[model samples]
Target: MTQDYGFALARERGIALGPIGHRIVEENELTRVWEVRLAPGEELGFHIHYHPYYVVSLGGGDNEIETIFGKTIATQEPLGHTVYIDEKRAIHKLTNRSDQTYLSRLIEFKAVRWTYDDDPAQARPEAGEQTPEGYAAAFREILEHTADLPWEPKSLKGLYQKMLWRDEETGASIALIKFDKGVGIPNAHAHASNQFMYCLSGKYRYIPTGTTLVAGSFYCNPVGSVHGPTIADEATIFLEIYDGPHYPVQPPWYTDPKDAT
Candidate 1:
């Protein structure tokens, strides 16, 4: 049996489709990771994007994106560039037009499947992880370059962050955080929703649980599960994501209201 992927309207509109990406490297309950690479003049045939997703550029190059509906775009992708797309278009394709190969890792949110419909409730926050809102009156498409974005200081000393994307209503967000060596969270804490992190570099440790994160480490902390009093053994950088609101109440570690998000 095949998944409906709920493309009734897309089919009715005569859109064609293909696989989501070039190659699947990993998949779990929450996400599917894809490695996308295209040599010069290579094209990815029409494909569907049925879930909310983001792309992390490993290497930058000129590329063109064409929708079956006929609109086309040509853009310069930058190294370390990131973008989040919430639109669930059923027909589109990309072609590498630069001299060098274009490489990226595209991650799709599988926990939430978005199908265009009129639903006001999706714009509202829920108790757990949320699905992408295809029906959102204004779903955002955020683009950022790690090298170009300035890191905002957190209230705590030696802590900083580059906010990539966020939901003002739900407090859900994705960010790149930095912790200087020896800097630490002074107390145990939990979050309002599941927290996910991928270490980009250096080492960080949870004192209470003795759990540690090193380069390439992946971590997940469940909602309301107490754990922390963490320290950076070395200067560290990590990508953090929250499935829903961040905290039941602002933790004392942060004095800046903006840091709470």
Candidate 2:
């Protein structure tokens, strides 16, 4: 399915073929998820990534990349290997050289130095009339190895997080959350903005809705909508995202705003 990931603004800026995927499967204020599939001997033509992007390889195979600068690089990654690329304004073409097809999901972080910042209409639409978070003086960057990122404690018991990226100015963030078995939010609550989640392993459930998320599941909770009283049915790890402030006011669970992050 063809979808716009700030493509309209890219075109307005004289960029014509900047898309990095065969199809964009999902997009919103926080991220654009692209599904890339390259059959043996096939190629994805020269494309540019305008924002920081991470890729999770599913069907890994022999692949080669040729940059606009004429550099050719060969690569092979095992299935489930993940990498984050903080390219310095790069452009390249990729080809699958192996007999087997290559498949992967590439997620472009829309909140990180987004291409449409000058136009508020194209920025986080859900941010709406609320104040956008302010930019911090410095934010950590993980160039290519996301597996090496360290996990930090959360104010909530039995929960931990690894912050992948964040837009300090917009309160937009992407994080990997791990919930220990038998632990979760103690009560129903709401978020200040939209929340997006993708389960990577194990299981969890929202008690009120009887909605459960397991490996490969995706969930979204819109702004101001109350839900939760959640529990981790098993030790769970999931990707969590937010498009704006986490809460209208700091929740009682967290005494330190730093821990809340």
Candidate number with greatest lDDT: 1
lDDT score at residue 260, model 2, on the 0-100 scale: 53
Cα miss at 239, model 1 (Å)? 0.3
Please give the RMSD of candidate 1 to the true structure.
13.7
Model 1 vs. true fold: TM = 0.52
Clashes of each: 0, 1
Supply candidate 1's per-residue lDDT for 204.
100
Tell me the spans in candidate 2 whose CA falls farther than 4 Å from its real position: 1-144
Model 2 is weakest, by summed lDDT over 10 consecutive residues, at: 135-144
Task: Show where candidate 1 strays beyond 4 Å.
Answer: 1-49, 52-140
Q: Please report, in order, the local distance difference test score of every candidate based on alpha carbons.
A: 0.76, 0.74
Q: After superposition, how far is residue 220 of candidate 2 from its true place, in Å?
A: 0.5
Clashing pairs in model 1? none
